[model samples]
Target: MRIGLDIGGTKIDAVAVAPTGQTVDRVRVPTGFGAEQVVANTLQVIDALRGRTGTTPTAVGIGIPGLIDHETGWVRHAVNLGLSEVALGPLVAEHVGLPVQVENDVNVAALGAAQAMHLDGAHAYLNIGTGLAAGIVVDRRLWRGARGNAGEVGHIPVLADGPPCVCGQRGCLETVASGSALAAAWPGHPGTTATEVFDSADAGDPAATAVRDRFVAGVASAVRILVVTVDVDSVVIGGGLAALGERLLLPLRADFDEAARSSPFVASLGLSSRVLLAPLDQPLAALGAAHLAPESAVTTA
Candidate 1:
């Protein structure tokens, strides 16, 4: 068995995956800063899950947000968690006494989504949740580009004079199209999540509807770039926002179709039905990490 920990801004998801591709048991705890406390929470979850599985985990994997250098076990910046230049993987390994690998959470989720598939072809995973990002899976391996910053698709600057991004860029895809933007425009709702905004738009709230339409354009534009760049067969959507289903998807599909309809470069791409909703609601990182543990690294004694 293997252990996977997905640390996010709001929650920490831990799971124990058996060898046969099953999530046998799961645990979750709210997330916080105080880096030491965050690591402690993960250890506690792992300790609690250790008993039932009957074997020491072959490996441990953690998924965190922000820019990470997986090779050096360094997290250059993780703003939501208030960490900068933290040696995250080594610290967690010290506490847990296991081989641990740390990676950008969205990338892990992408791997997990890909892992859930048949694995005979290339695919992409797009997560639009509290934020927007992607993970690329080609030929059954993650395309971690040079410097491990391959999938910073959210900051890819789709607009020239767009709104300001947390990354300090203007007109970035995440600024105008993500859950944060929808929540900013409509603040008083019961559920300020992305789903609620779409629900409000579905119910005819003008402000919500405006953001919804803009969001579709933005998402379709982003997906088009991904399709053209990566040439993947399909893109899977996961995370909190995806719970809204076709209420969000239909419009996105329409936009992608409209955008790709006339491009000769994208003509033979066959991307009309390329976008797909993830079968699993939880983000993919933790599971992908756990699944990767033993095989990704080998010991020499």
Candidate 2:
């Protein structure tokens, strides 16, 4: 059996998958902030998942939400978690009495999305949650890029003088398109979440509607970047805003269509139809983690 864990900002999800690609057990627990608590919570979930199956996991994979060094097995930086540098692989392996593989959560989710959806040829998984990023898969193989930061599109500048990003840059895609950005831009109600912003737009609130429109444009821009740069066979959309479902897709599709109609170059790319929704039936990152072991069938390479 192989075990996979997705350590996110709000929750820790775990799953055990048999050699046949069937999940035998799964568990979820609230994520603890900071390094020590996060590790403890992750270990707890692993133990619980193992206990449910009454079998030892042959390999374990963990998806972390930050900058990770594949060679050093250390998390270089996790801005949201306030984690600077930590040896997550060694610590988890020591506690679990087994070897562990660690990778960025979005990258693993891309792997999971590709496997679950059985995408062919080149594919990209766009994660528009608290931040914006993408994971690329070429010919069913993951392309992590040099330094394992291949898909850091959130920092890509889109607007010349838009909002500021945590990375100390102005007009980054993350500042305009991510869930965090939506919440930050919401002017109708204080502490309103991204989902509520979508809801407010549905209710016909002008301010909320404007924010929603801007968000849609930003997201459409992100999609265009992937379509033009990599021209993947498919682009899978996932992450927190996914819960908005059709409300999100409608505007995104509209924006893409508008762009295509105006520019023959855009229409030839066929970017609108290439965009797809990621499967939400399972925790993608965790499932991708299950396939992370070097010897596992779902290899990232």
> What are the TM-scores, per candidate, against the unseen true structure?
0.87, 0.89
Put down candidate 1 lDDT per residue, 1-301, tens digits, no spaces: 8888888887788888887878888888877785776767777778877876667877788888888777656788888887788877777677667777777887788778877765547777878876788887776567887766665678888889987888899888887667786676567653555766677788999987887898877777667778777777888876667776787688987766665577765656655688888876554787877755354432221
On lDDT, the candidate that comes out on top is 2
Candidate 1 has its poorest 10 consecutive residues by lDDT at: 292-301
Q: All candidates: CA RMSD in angstroms?
A: 2.8, 3.2
lDDT of 2 by residue, 1-301 (tens): 9899898888888999998888888898988788888878888998898888999988788888888875556788886666778888777777777768888899889888977888879888999887899998876567888766777788998889877898899999999888888878874554447778888888999988999999988888888888788778888889978777788888888888888899999889887788888988988999888777454222222
lDDT against the true structure, each candidate? 0.75, 0.83
Q: Give the TM-score of candidate 1.
A: 0.87
Tell me the spans in candidate 2 whose CA falls farther than 4 Å from its real position: 79-82, 188-192, 293-301
